[model samples]
Target: MADGQDLMERIGRLRPAVRAAGQPLHRPLLLLWAIAQAVHGRPRQQPWSVVKHELAPLLTQFDGAQRGERDVVYPFWALQRDGLWEVADSAELPLTSGGRRPTFAILEQVNPLAGLPEADYNRLIDDSTVAADALSTLLVRFFGANSGSVVEALRLREFVRGPIGASLLPLVGEQYADRKKIAEAYGGNGVMGITPLADGILAVYSDDKGPYPDHHIPETGWIAYTGDGLSGDQTLTVGNKSMQEYQKQEKALRYWHKPYNGSWTFETWAVVIQCRRRWGRGEDKKQRREYVWVLAPVPSPLRETWPSDVVEALAQDDKSVHDDSVDVIPAEVVAGQESRKLSAQERYQQLSDAARRTDGNRTNRSKPTLVERYMRSAAAREAVIIRSEGRCENPACGGHPLERTDSGQPLLEVDHVNGLARTGQDTPEFMIALCPNCHALKTRGAGRGELQKSLVPVARKLHRAMQRGERRKARPDGT
Candidate 1:
């Protein structure tokens, strides 16, 4: 029988997938949900049918970036790896040929019961002190300053220790002569954009005149800050590390803005609500990896005055990290910006030249935002759509549906042949246009890898055919 300390240690050592896509919370969240169930004296074991129904909403609320039924399936089955969970009818359970858990549909049919083992459940239920210790370990380790909100959300207030929410610095906006003056006021080096100040406050400087220009989304009161690094792709170190740490801890950021011609002015309190890895041109006028942090502006006066939505978003453990480099631009926005028509061959040449120049050694030292990536890849996406000519590019796909978009164009999604995760080049030769159904299947289907493999040659062939002024209308019967 594992004691409370043992359980706390296990919770602390949870091995979530370490990827560029941010840490997955599926396991920790599942354990926390189980702890919540224990607090309410629920049964030790519950079927997947019941657990998914109850846990799906919590997962959706805390893990907003991940969607669909698959999210719930991972935690329910994967938690067993930590040795704290178990499943009934183990031999009877269905699994894939590789001895792994089957799809959620297959698991649903089996409906095996799973949860914390009997001994662990009994310990958590019988001893309130042990349960509180375990809950505190999970909350502090995963939720940080947002633990209080998690407690409230899970109705675990009775099991938590210490006060919730860190004390924030007072609303003080001032003007500084230069970086040195700002550094003297704050604790970190004045030269860096993101710096650590006293009492866990982050000093973020946005210089409009510099290579990285910050953009403000007025609708959400969010600032999309292009992260620090001058020559090449940015890494998780130094100023960028501080930004990530503060984001995970849900600490407030002391923002300052430097206009093109004016002195540095302290802005307002902010928090890094979201962060994404995107391809941006660096100092050498080539595409390089960059981190774009979306900082949410906090209301002034006091933390108590913040709206409920702001508070809730700050409490999310995932922080909605977008790992892909592609910045999705609306089709309408692309059409509006690219009014000058270029032939298929001409558009392909432009993208090819851009790709060749940005071979990782150089990048354009401009502030790369959603608009920048859109302008660069708009031609690539359009060229692929044009090549498809109202037909699905997937050779195996049935005829595209009769549905048309609002503009009377065929409804299709442009996808990279190698996938964005693999850093697929955003060029006409490496892209394909697919109908909505085929696109979804390619993205999330079990055979997506096979499908992606099949599309690679197809995309190349189509681009060549289109260049020869050949229009290959897709067969209605998928011949």
Candidate 2:
């Protein structure tokens, strides 16, 4: 029997060789070698429990040995656990069958050869490695072909090179196959299956292969074909010939058509709506109603079926309830913006004078003075106050106020509880922000009765909340 020292030496030598045999053989070979020795010359095939039971005791004895921990050793032990090998089954032994008892001699037969022919086996391994790498590269390139133009180019090259090139190219002809497999595996739109044309090109013919609908091709641009290849007596122009043709051919075709007075032209339609809002006296003395004038475009098909009321409204100068009109205006003239009857400067001057008088003739009542000098500065401060309040304070209005407008700045005037002109307190608490329509109604003495009753209680609650927050800050630990 080999001594324990001799067995240890043998195992140490085998470890390096097993590891050098590549990733696949590393653990399996180590476990196989260990199991072979433990079962050497045994007639009874031991169960995994028996093998593990035998090996477990040695772990403590070999604890401080040169080898590592249980993780390194458990893999070898697991081989028996998993049924890769068996303890010597006496019934299968030739000697037990009346010939000769199978001894340690069979161990050599079962174990991998210590001196495996390196060249022959290594060549097979190397070829497999190269094939795997090639397949990966081919798959990457095939997936990268996202466009029809790219697919067509690949097809052309494959056709020119013929069978030999196709075999060499990673996924030359199997573009659709790779795409479909990848899509299915990853759960996306399946590969686009395009038909190969005679000119060594591929064209998308249908949407059957994809998960989604195919691109729409207008009837005018769609071409029909009768043959398997591009060449045929019956052919339809699926694409604009000029757009598809080579640059050289494109210029040549243009020159040929020039003498025939054939030219490409473009046209567009304009749909305009003219709306005007007018208020007039009603039959009831105290009631006034607003009238709306609407002019809308009518499509060519609906021209004959146009509503008579709409047409008559547009024809008359008076305001109408509804109107629709269709008139042909030259495309070039319609393309430009319509001319304004009044200039901006004239409107600005008129608005400035009106605003000055509305501001109660405040000192320095110029246009820019009223706006940039006072109103803009006040609007900025009001925006800050609105943000601070978090919402509209008016009890009648519960909506959050997210915006403040310069146009509504006149209505957002700082209103003092005792009147700004009288109290002179410009503090945020003294002033309340209100929307333009709401502010107008308040000034006209419409909603003040409700607002005055609500504001007092809201101010008292807010003041108490501030006092409670101050008290909490003053005393870090409650006494």
List, in order, the clash count of every candidate structure: 8, 5
Report the lDDT tens digits of candidate 1 across residue range 1-479: 76765665466457565456556666777888888888898888888888888777777766663565667887887788787788887767778747766678877888889899777888898888778767755654455545666678888886654443222222355788788876555445767778644322457888888888578853355687988887687898878876887677565667888887888887877777667776566766545678877777765422454666567666653755565444332233334557775555555455455543332322332222332343356456755765676677887786455457654767888888887547535577888988888888888989988998989899988878876767676475643
Off by over 4 Å in 1: 1-170, 198-200, 300-303, 315-317, 326-479
- Global lDDT scores for all candidate models: 0.67, 0.28
RMSD of each: 22.0, 33.5
- Cα deviation in Å at residue 422, candidate 2? 3.3
Best by TM-score: 1
TM-score of each: 0.38, 0.17
Q: What is the lDDT of residue 111 in candidate 2?
A: 28
**What's model 1's overall lDDT?**
0.67
Write candidate 2's Cα lDDT for 1-479 as tens digits.
22322322222222111122211222333333233332232322433333334434333222222332332333332233332333344345333224433333343344212211223223223343322222222221221222123223223222222211122221312223333443332222333222211111122223233222222122111111111112221111232211122111111000000111322111110011122221222222121222211112222111233344324323442221211111111112223434753232332223323333334444543322222223222322332233223334344543323344442222243343434444333333444555544455455656676665565555444334432332212222211
Checking candidate 2 for backbone clashes, the offending pairs are 45-87, 45-88, 46-87, 95-100, 95-101
User: What TM-score does structure 1 among the candidates reach?
Assistant: 0.38
